[model samples]
Target: MTELVRMTGIEKRFPGVHALKQAQFDLKRGEVHALMGENGAGKSTLMKILSGIYRPDDGTVEIDGQPIELSGPKAAQAHGIGIIHQELSLMNDLTVGQNILIGKEPRRSFGRLDERELNRQAGELLGSMHMKLDPKTIVAELTIARQQMIEIAKALSNRSRILIMDEPTAALTDAEVSELFAIIGRLKSEGVGIIYISHKMDELKRIADRVTVMRDGEYVVTVEAADTPVSTIISMMVGRALKEETVTIPDLDTAETALSVRGLNRGRVIRDVSFEVRHGEILGFAGLMGAGRTEVARAIFGADPKDSGEVFVHGKPVSIGTPKDAVRAGIGYLSEDRKHFGLALGMDVRANIAMASLGQFTDMAGRLDEKAMQATANDYIERLAIRTPDDRQEVQLLSGGNQQKVVIAKWLLRDCDILIFDEPTRGIDVGAKGEIYRLLAALAADGKAIIVISSELPEILRVSHRIAVMCEGRLTGILPGGAGTTQEEIMHLATLRDAMTEEHA
Candidate 1:
């Protein structure tokens, strides 16, 4: 293996923070190098510098033993460097071929796009990766996995010698992840250097050749993946030893039903879903993406209208047609896409937290009680351990984990008995995820009926009192709270989404 990329003495600074401090990174051809760290640890910042999105205040980047300056994104692309961001960056209305070959399309002599050639080339690229999809297919028509495959194809199309993937498997299913690993194996065999940035420790052990740990904007150490234990990696990344333990609460077997849905139906998204959540239970909805887990939650919370379903609270039938109706019925929903749906990003933390319960603070004359709202928001900020300078700070400025806490705080302040959390830990860091888990555990112990929908099997297993698996809009199976339920069981249900057998029917 030869050094394909070397970045030394990288230093970046903001107004009050050293975003990166003398950080160093190295990548070798034909190897998968993993960068591990918590959120705000400056992993992304360092990679941005590599991709020419940012110029380091101080550093030297050497490629093939020659120092090179990356002035911009185009320069990086010309140098055979490419990055696939954590969020998919595709135009939904465009065709797959257009997205893959954007900016560098094949053109005819007249300078017009040669559509046939473009499609043929894109199809070949997909075929090479063992992906079965039409290049002419609209991006919106593809699954998340297929879209990710298109992203990879786009990178390869750019003749990327050094590829950077940030949380590439975050939204993928087990089968999709396996396919991605196969593609990675092929890339490695072809001597393509890959920089994998992920919080998933297990993935590093499975795929990476070496692991580079970063903490608080500084490189801590680098070690062979096979020789280093996950515990060692975690300690290096966080600058402290962190415990990996599951927190369990006592069984709430005899608790009253907080929310019950009978025959919940929402077109093709949710079908004949029926479940009951008891008070003090963290009932987890486990399945792959597009499994209707989030759809079920939306229907139950009245974020979307269901075709037919009966919702009950304390055995009393309730009519919930909208979010207001759900709230009136003592239900609150935290959408998975918190930035877009759950929170008003531009609003201050105090405003977001008090948004749901504003009416409670209004007097008989319709006068707003600013003092009461501030006090309430301040209380939740302290209790949730939200890392914000002040409640007056905008939610957008806070980290992903803190923003999620604000959403949770809003619902908690509203006194909602049935809480629906959809991918509550998505985009959250490892350390922050643990804190959120602990908070959820405490909430369940306090007798809140919690329905947690998560794509991460480990998170679902660690947090839930019981696990319910959904496949293609149907509830396939429900398992007990304890260690009997495994990731394999959930995956089995996730993949069995085509159709139910006659016996099952």
Candidate 2:
């Protein structure tokens, strides 16, 4: 294989932060090299330098064995480099063909836009990549997975030989992931080098040829994927050994029922859902995508309207027609898409922490007590082990894991007893995941009723005292959470609909 990209002595700095320190990375043609790290490990910072999004304060970038200084994104693209960010960057209002050839659209005589040629070229590119999308379809009407494919199409349209994919499978289904891997295979055969960045350790085995680990903005080590253990890679990334242990179910027979839901229904999305979480207990929700796990949580939290249901807090029925009402009834919901639904990204950590319970920090004259808010925010910041310079730091500057902790702090400051966490560790790194798991356990031990909804079966087993499985908007079964419960059992309950369909046939 030929060397495609190399960066040596890469260094970058921002105000009050050293984003990268003497970092180094290299890629070879026809290889998939993975970059693994914790949320704040500077993976994005390094990649930004490679993709011309940011210029390193000190470093040398070489493309195709030739040293080059990339002035901007266009310069990098001119050198056959393309990056697809974690957040899709397509214009939703445009057609797929228009987005794919945005600035490079073909023109006819008299300098008129050649719409037909544009669609034809886009169709050819999608077909070559084995995508089944029509070029004329509106971008906003496609699913996340399909939109991801379009991003790839757009990258390939630039004649890119070096491709960088960041968290590409985060929003994809199993079938979609298989499709993506197939495309990667095709690209590799064509001698295209790929830099894959993802937090899902399992993917390294399936797709990556080599794995590179970075920690706290510095290069650690790189090794062949086939010769390294996942544990070794994790240790290199987090600087410590992580204990993989199952949950120890506590005896909650005498515990008070903190939250109860009965006959919950919302159109066909949620059908007759019912569950209970006792004080000092963690109840896990497990199911396939679209299995109504999130829907049930939203209805219970009053984020979505439930056609028919009764919510009981402390064994007493409560009316929760709105999010404010649910909060008043001692319920706090952490949404799965935390960036959009959970936090004010531009606000400081102190303001975001006090956002949920502003009234508590306000005096009779309607003036906020800034000192009190700062004191409370700082306390939670320390208690939660949030890695931030101070409470006044912008939440957007923090990593994904720390931002999630801030959301948790907001709810805790509100003093909600019944907490519902939806995909609490989604998009978070493994090291941070352990911290979140510990936090959930401590909260449960402190007698806070908790409901955790997760797509990953192992996470559900690790955090829950009891597991509730759903299928096609209905509760299939509930099982004990521990070593006694296997992933197979959870899968069976999750695919109950398929089993029933076969039986009926």
Candidate 3:
């Protein structure tokens, strides 16, 4: 009901990019105010300024109608501000209690860690949120969802009155999201002002009181959550409307099987996962995160070592122990994390495109044919409609969707017959999502065996010819993709097996 935090005329600039321009944001006490924008829209930049991660070139910050200067994160923390970053900042080797209550450990007289007392404090903090994680459990051994919970616990330990959550539900399951929402509601009741940033529209309607949309580093509009339509919000955030429609899948019933995996196993992530993908089929692997979908693809593409598995390409068994073998077998893998695994961020688009199949563009003298490589990259760039100032630009400078196109271009240029796309549309805008979907459909139509791994149930239903769901380390069931399939049905199979069921199986 009262103003808890406000930033007026906030401006931040990087080397050549004006990241934020006079952005205005205000959060009321006990309210969840959502910050909406596409990637590079300055949502994170603006919030970082507020959290003292960056010093704004120009701005005025006010808390409780009083102007305040935030010199650093410590200052922000002193002012009751806490931020849960998009990426988990936990030390993998540390225990949950140690990470959550870092630097604030209760010491007993001497310099001892006071292990029992530390866990007791941590347990109380988790208990407040109804979390059952043991404080002494190693963070490395925890699931992504559990790690996220620990992040939240760490934030709450600060006794923060203003919480900034960036894409909090990015890795959470439906059930876990619900649990988080419950905690958020409790925080709201306790008069905690929350700044929530997410691309998920449905969540805003459920949790947010007000919505603020930004586009092109400028604040667009602010509207009450109850009154604004999701479509209107999306249009404002992306500067355009997106028609959500299913991609057109070509007829591939008679296409020959392109890839066949038999008894695939990678530790406990994947177990006996066997499937066949036809040349013109888009086989979708649908499940919750850590359901072995990505693992299966990585193992097949030889990104990860297979404990035991056999891969067959076009009816012939292929020995794939490394990525080189997979590439020779005409297989290409598009990693889920584009920034880390998919592309070389430091290299130009043409170089990255030619990376996978450099031999094709190399002369007998072992020197690269720059002109030929540029021509090839340019052709695919134009064909895929990749938006870039020039093909010479670095792939990292491109937008999320455009970077994904570059990754796809690299594989396609390598003449890979079987392609695996993992979370291809993640961090991509809605309009670009459609473009990527169309690209995938066209690739399938051209007889490229396609395996798509996605967490979005709607994506799986729309683009897949056949759907496979994994639970724990096992492939539980497969469904015919169409109108008959539902998200609930997929989730049922995704979490079907527990320890007891695994023993029985």
lDDT of 1 by residue, 95-129 (tens): 99999999988999979999999999999988887
Residue 75 of candidate 2: its Cα lDDT?
Answer: 90
Identify the superior model by TM-score, candidate 1 or candidate 2: 2
Local accuracy of candidate 2 as per-residue lDDT tens digits, 233-352:
999999999998666788899999999998899998788877788999999998877788888998988888999999999999999888999999999999987887899999999999
Return the lDDT, model 2, position 77.
90
Tens-place lDDT per residue, model 3, 208-298, is: 9999988878989999999999999988888788877775656666779899988888888988777789998888888777788878888
Once superposed on the true structure, which residue ranges of model 2 sit more than 4 Å away at CA?
90-159, 498-505
Q: Please give the RMSD to the true structure for each candidate, in Å.
A: 3.2, 3.4, 3.6
Assess every candidate by TM-score: 0.90, 0.91, 0.89
lDDT of the candidates, in the order given: 0.86, 0.90, 0.86
Could you give the candidate ranking by TM-score, starting with the highest?
2, 1, 3
